[model samples]
Target: MSVKTKLRAPSTVLVLLALCLLVSVFAISGGEYQMTPWQVLKVLFGQGEGIENMVIWQWRMPRAVAALLFGAALALSGAVFQSLTRNPLGSPDIIGFSTGAYTGALITLTVLGGGFVATSLGALTGGLLTALLVYLLAWRNGTAGFRLILVGIGISSVLASFNHFLVLRAELDVAMAAAVWGAGTLNGLTWQSVTPVGILVVLVSALLLANSSQLRMLQLGDDLCRALGMRVERTKLLLVVLAVFLVAAVTSLAGPIAFVALVAPQIARRLAGSAGLQLVPTALVGALLLASSDLLAQRLFAPVQLPVGVVTVCFGGLYLIYLLNRRTTKV
Candidate 1:
């Protein structure tokens, strides 16, 4: 990136940060226990009285942090998958990781009745297993991104059907609980819930961002990348593993929060005018998108806060349609 590009990128990031801050303030100040902006600031600074500080630190802070981490994780994973495949539609959900994670979580919730730790473990195992299955099935001596994506979609559909069947066979309350979990929510997020996700996001995101240069190179076809001293297949495998882990982490915690992964990188790419993964910008955009979505979900239907997943799905589905239409015209 040129000096001008570097300057412009930080400028864009500052703008996004400003937006996130504004939404976060709104989210903190406008909920059931409302507070003024001044009160919010005071609480954040640890100079406030009882209620405001408790609300800000204990409640809103965790939820906001969860939104940021989860959103960033999903977006980064999506960007990695898209760049690796050189396909805009490539994402963990598209390639079966999300479904697998969901299925795993469902099994835990249904049969095991374990706590969050157990469910998360199940999600991680499910996501990795699903990706491995897809890779094995898609492999014909070697894996091509195109064939892998096709096989993944087929496997994901099968798993999704199975998930529905499992839910249907369960008791009504259990099915509702499963359905709600699948929809994704930020309600009642605690430090306990955020710890695993936070660690996973930070670690995986750093690895992915550190490898952004290699990812950009990989985008230029496998043979060309190999000629450039890049181990094309091995790098792709690493990316797939990283992507699966990121998806598993967030989906387990947030119930496969939809569309942030699908939407954030596209928005970041347009804003940055970069052909490949704009890692930092994509992450910032993802945070902003999710934070704003959370705020909207809370305030839109007064006293009836929707899950963050619903908002992303509605917004993401429309954005995806637009992407497909645009791609068709370009073709």
Candidate 2:
């Protein structure tokens, strides 16, 4: 008789990383002129022909990489907020920060008319301001997750109207361009724009890493966290700032990618079999999700090439409905 043993599977984070890398390979291989995954790997390792190298290294690589990074950033931000608020629905999209960022962008496109730098600055400034507003409004001695969400919803509604007004008032050409960007397409992404985003991702990730312990402490309820010597309000403020920075940066670049922030953390929580959202697995899930969405956006409609946001919304909307049906508690 032979004895047989079953081995345990890999860690959820590792599995997600592997999946993310696999999706990225296919992402680089896709686009107008397709290539094989083997060819993409060769080009990645500095082999392949000039045109192949140009296509893989120069063109598609930046967009693919950006999608991965931005996805991770959004998920990390979402994890921070959800854990901080102890709310399943805590996300930038729900919290009005993304809409506020878009409002700033509309102002930049219409009023400043300045170039990329000014617009980026405008978006960042706008989101941070909105975060502050939400925090202040939600605070009645201390912020509760439910109050915060309600305030955010109200603010987002107001901003959406303002955003439309700005777009309608702008020149037709500029309005058209802004609309496309607002849709969150990765088309025409180049290394020049991607470099700064990459740097921002690194810096923000480091900040999150350093504050990770505090984040865990915060999750254990504010009174308990305070009793354990955590400066509850200060930590909350700092984490909120970091979260807003992430959402704003992604919105500035990719136009508030839908559902990556909202969905990834919750999904990762289940996959990792954890009661709370874990950052590492969540980030990987986010990377895989956004990359997969971008790939689908490219090929699903073929030459038409829908914006990445459209696919995310289509899929995310379904998830939202299912979540609602579950009757999950807000906090």
Candidate 3:
């Protein structure tokens, strides 16, 4: 990137950050017991009254923070995958990771009948196993994006059927509970619930950011990357693993919240005019999309909040239609 291009990106990031902050404030300030934006800020800084603190710090904050953090995580994963595939539709969820995670959670709930932590672990395990399976299946000579996606689709279809079967066979209470979670809401998130996974996500994100030069280099054709003496396949595999981890972590917390992952990187790349995926800006866009969507989900049907995933799915469907239309026109 040129100096001017680099400068533009940072400015774009700053603006996105500012928008995220504003949206977060708005999100925390809305609800049954609404507060002013100033009050929300005060509560965040630990200077509000009992109710404000309880509402903002205790209830609203975790959900909002989860939206921002998980959204960013999803976007970071998307950036990695899209950069690797050189396709706008290249999202981790396009593979079976999210479905695998959901299947894991379903099994845990139906068999072990475990609580949140157990369920999250189950989801993580399932996601990783699914990734391994897809990688192996796609590795004819070496992994290619189209083959990987195709394998993922098949695996996801099988896993999704298994998930439905599990849910159908389980007790009604257990099935209903699993179904709600599978719908992907930020409704009941608490600090305790979000902390461990949040920390892991931060670490994973740090690793991805640190090794991002390799991701950018991988975009320059395998032969060219090999010419530069990089272990092309190994770097690609490592980055793919890291990207999968980000998705699994997010899925563990919020179920399969879609669209944010598929859309964020493309939006960020356009906004910043980046030649390749720019991680920070993509993350910021994801954060904004999720936070804002969650806020709408909470208020759009006041007193009967919809799962945030529902809003994202609606938006995602529209995005897909637009993408298809664009591709068709070009063809």
Candidate 4:
């Protein structure tokens, strides 16, 4: 890589990181009980007193951090899937993994009466199983990206229906809880809730980054990648598994916040002008998107909060329609 390009990646990442910080501070500053950016910073640094400290540290800070972490995880997961499948549409949300994770959480909440731990396990189980099924069904002579995407879409539709059924069949209170969770809000998130997933995101993201070299090779097509001495199938499988873990981790914590994964990587790629996937930039974009959305969700209605997922769905749904229309026109 040229020195300019090398410098550009870090510089772009720095800009994104700065934006994420700015948005997070903005998010923390706004709410039912608003604070100035200066107050938020003071509270963050242990200088604020009483309610200011409680609001910023105990409540708003954790939620903002969760939003940032979840966004980064989803974005990185999307980038990995897109790279593996070579399809812009190949996201966990589009491919049924998110639906599957939702189903798992529903079962935990409704049937097992489990708490966050149970729900997290269930979500991970559901997402991994769905991915496996999609991969197996898509397998022919080999797994084609288009075929895998189609199979995932089909499975996702079915799982989505099942998820709806689960919600409906659940008892009233349980159903209500599941419905809210399905909508994907970051409300009431404490440090306890954020810690485990935060750790997982950090670890899994590091693994993905370490494998970034091999991942870029796979984007060049299997034959060429294999010619370069990469074990194409093994690498793809590992990457997909890691991607599944990342998606499940976020879904379990945030309840399938949509379209950050689907949109962030594309945004990052466009910003960086990178031919291959830009993982770090994508993660930053994801963080910024989710944190900003959460902030909007909190203050948009002022006392009455909307789910962050609702905002994402609004934007993501339009983007999906546009992508389909563009693809149709091209075809």
What TM-score against the true fold does each predicted structure earn? 0.95, 0.95, 0.96, 0.96
User: How high is the lDDT of residue 8 in model 4?
Assistant: 82
By TM-score, is 1 or 3 better? Answer: 3
132-233: candidate 3 lDDT, tens digit per residue = 899899998778887888898899899989988998999999988778878888988999989999999999999999999999888888899999999988
Clashing pairs in 4: none
What lDDT does the true structure give each of the candidates? 0.86, 0.85, 0.88, 0.89
What tens-digit string does per-residue lDDT give for candidate 2 at 1-331?
A: 1122111113676788888888999878877798999998898888899999888878988999999999988888888888877777888888888889888877887888967777888889999999999999999999998889889989999998898888888999999988888888888889998889678887987798689889988878899998998899999999889888888888877787878888998898888766754777888888888999999998898877788989888878898888887865553
Error of 1 at 45 (Å): 2.1
Give the TM-score comparing model 4 with the true structure, all chains together: 0.96
Clash list (residue pairs), candidate 3: none
Which rank order by lDDT, best down to worst?
4, 3, 1, 2
Give candidate 2's error at residue 12 in angstroms. 1.2
Q: What would the per-residue lDDT of candidate 1 be over residues 98-217, giving only the tens digit for each residue?
A: 999999988888878877899999999999999889989988877777887898899999999999998998889899988888898888889888986798779988998888888888
Q: Which scores higher on lDDT, 3 or 4?
A: 4
Give the distance in Å from residue 45's predicted Cα in candidate 2 to where it truly belongs.
1.6
